[model samples]
Target chain A: MYRQPVSRLWWLKKRTYFVFVMRELSCIFVAWFAVFLMVMVFAIGRGEASYQRFMDWAASPVVVAINIVALAFLVLHTMTWFVLTAHATPIRVGGRRVLAMREARVAGRIVPAATAVRVGGRQVPAAMVIASQYAGLVVVSAFIAWLVLR
Target chain B: MTKRHIEPIVWLLFSAGGVAAAVFLPILILLFGLAIPLGWVRPDYNYLDAVVSHWLTRLVLLGLLVVMLFHSAHRFRYTLHDGLQLRWEVPIAVLSYGGALLGSAAALLIVLTI
Candidate 1:
């Protein structure tokens, strides 16, 4: 058995690998968000004065910029994870695979329908999985917005 | 007790954390990190305070914080291991999971206090 030698800079050797590395690196931003929220929670727990100070700190140009970048990476993380979920877990409806109909022929006429996106041998459509994840994100975000901003 | 036995548990935490962060972190970060801070949206302090003080909110926050920490830990662990090509598995796992545990404990304390 022979194993090919790989370099530590392999991630830099290709665009997709680089993207994968960036995806992995998104964990740092994720951790940062968690810590930031913890700090905010602590401030809120401490009362109005501390919470105001937190807001002021958060408003600083540097913090805002970092957060903007974090937001971008987080979006990437969400997207890649959702796509992976579609590939990894196949959904079943009524003990049958959930599929998005691509096209159906009726009476010698082609009728357009939902696009079918299958992952290898998996029966569930990738589009359906991705769509459901995004829908979930939308609903969750909307609820949070309502809770916070209402 | 054995490393084999611990592997599945760690993976479970990682998956839970990944799902939690993917679904929840984006919106939360957008709100607190960007929207509120950038003045795109204003959050009333009293109302926000009341929301945070709610028992359900505290519970949810605690759960999210714990899982998110674990998720970060697991990913960072692999990033160091395979990405950075580090061979020290024991130390890496210890630090990654240990930090997550500590963060979870702190989150629990903070949320309970709130």
Candidate 2:
């Protein structure tokens, strides 16, 4: 039996798929943050001097660049995951639901449009879902930014 | 218990960890990596030490480390399988999860001793 080789750039076929692959790719940065946390803990445990040294290392330009880049990816990861989570976690306010139909489509479940509407309760618009997602992201990112820059 | 039996529990941990990391980690990183370094907010060492050494704080820290590592393990395992197309499933799974367990243990010890 012969199997066709999947293209390396298969993800480029769709924007959603690309975003998903990027989401998976962002796990590396997540792990990097975990490692960074471990280092911080170890340094703090070693006392003030080591902690100061760790801070110095973290302050280096290269590290700052890395952190900035990591921050972007982390935001993407968080936003995408929340959107996916929103699909599973239904929230009703004033009898209105903000359903992420994109997630259902992403799952590749051949659900009828009517079924999707029924699942979400009155077909929440895609724009509304995206808007809410970005709104949440902005609030979160702002809080963190304030903590950092204030 | 079979693999299927344990998979759901592990996935639940991974999901919880992901949520926690998403909610908490960005702030921590910003504070330590940027704010402190850039002198935006100068928190004294004594204050930080006291906070880290507090029993409740250490417990919470330990919890975050453990679950975050588990999240890393699950994600890394799938990354290898799905992203890199690595066919060696068993070794990768064991190494990823085992490394996470060891990392959690080490973090626990460090927190306890601190």
Candidate 3:
């Protein structure tokens, strides 16, 4: 059973809800990673004494396990969460005409970069900007994992 | 083409993140398992920045958090709509804008506090 056709209680599905919660709230794990990074930065910025204390504090088994679990959750959540992005922004081609599934598929597959007169206003493709943002995110996330993992 | 397209860049950013998760998770889990007992991947390491003094590192952390935050918030907004089956633009608009605003504020707090 999916979300009911038209009722207010549709937003909450037990399974999807858990997955979304696991995914969305996994931001907390990323937050944990970021905070750890900030503290490390500040500690290093502060002094060797601070850095020593930081490592000593992190050496506890309980704390380490939590980060690991958080990392696992963060990874799973990120993948599943982003897959749903396609539903968020559907594209329409042509003037006031229905978007056929074939056209939608083609558009999604290829990176389109054309300035066309949209239904009401013209849409200019900013392909470069989008590319930069995604690249930045991937590089950044990967770099951090490398640092901590190493 | 006479058709307006959904910005492929958006999908690329989204799916790229997804793909990263796919590629990265196994490695993380493996490391976490390997490092868990050694005091390397500890819970408090979540606060590893306390020892780091790297500008590039902090910036990277910020980038990752911001991207993940926006990506999550944006997706969550739609999940609300699709799951709720809410057809009215007015309410959907309010919910999404409000959600984004709240999420952004929370992110700022997290960033600023520590």
Instruction: Report the number of the highest-TM-score candidate.
Output: 1
lDDT of 2 by residue, B67-105 (tens): 878887887887666655666888998988898899888
What TM-score does model 2 achieve against the real structure? 0.76
Candidate 3 per-residue lDDT, tens place, B34-111, comes to 354355565445344452325554454455444544444444444455444445745654554454356445545444
Q: Candidate 2's C-alpha lDDT?
A: 0.71
lDDT of candidate 1 over B1-114, digit per residue (tens): 227667556656766778788999889988999888778998899899999999999999988888889889988987887787777988988998899999999898889887
Candidate 3, TM-score vs. the true structure?
A: 0.43
**C-alpha RMSD over true interface residues, each candidate:** 7.7, 4.5, 7.4
DockQ of 2: 0.36
Residue A101 of model 1 has an lDDT of 37
Q: lDDT by residue for model 1 over A31-112, one digit each (tens)?
A: 9999999999999989999998998999999999999899999999999998877765655544443435344342233433
Residue A64 lDDT (model 1): 92
Candidate 2 on A66-92: residue-level lDDT in tens? 888887777777777666555554444
Clash count list over all predictions: 0, 0, 21
Model 1: residue A144 alpha-carbon error in angstroms: 0.4
Better of 1 and 3 by TM-score: 1
Off by over 4 Å in 2: A1-3, A90-150
Model 3 C-alpha lDDT per residue in residues A17-104, reported as the tens digit of each score: 5565566555445445534544544554555577667656655777677766876786676455444332322333445633222222
The local distance difference test score of each candidate is 0.83, 0.71, 0.47
